[model samples]
Target: MKVASFLEDVKFNSNKPSVLMLMDTDFSKELRVVFKKGQIMEDHQAPFAIVVQVIKGAIDFGANEELIQLNDGDLVSLKPHIVHNLSAAEDSVVRLTLSKADSLQRVKNV
Candidate 1:
């Protein structure tokens, strides 16, 4: 079995959000994203469905121009190719889980 703490051992970047790849396998890919207050992850899209969970703090999540506020313990799912963006209202940690697909696609900025 494998285990990890998303809240521990986090790495931060001054120019961009910090990303940590927690797992990457045939079945799924898991990542941890850390954003400082006011940081924004510009709109992007993925080729496979994904689940995003807020682990700490808050964020404004936008999908296809629809905005929603997410706080710790809140989760949302996005289907393939849906345009999305994230802005941290405060320093935050988010976990992203991507399901298996023919190939993992990089987040394409919109």
Candidate 2:
């Protein structure tokens, strides 16, 4: 068995979001992403489905043309190729899970 603390041992970046990759395997990939207030992740699309959960603080999350405010304990999911973006409303920690192994492999090769 493996164990980790999503809230511990993280280093935040002032210039951009800090990403801590927790796991990557044939079925899924998990990441702990930390964002400082005012930082943003510009619009992007993933070829695979994804799940995002807010662990701490708040964020403005945009998917396609829809925008939603996310707070700690809130979770959201997106279909493949759906454009999405996010900005920190406050310093935040988010857990992102990518669910397509093949797509992740392609991304890693790029």
The TM-scores, one per candidate, come to 0.89, 0.88
Clashes of 1: 0
**Candidate 1 whole-model C-alpha lDDT, 0 to 1:** 0.83
Tell me the spans in candidate 2 whose CA falls farther than 4 Å from its real position. Answer: 100-110
Writing each residue's lDDT as its tens digit, candidate 1 over 1-98 gives: 66778899877667777777777777887888888989898988788889999999898999987999999999999989898999999999999888
Error of 1 at 75 (Å): 0.4
lDDT of model 2 at residue 30? Answer: 81
The models' CA-based lDDT, in order, is: 0.83, 0.83
Alpha-carbon runs more than 4 Å astray in model 1: 102-110
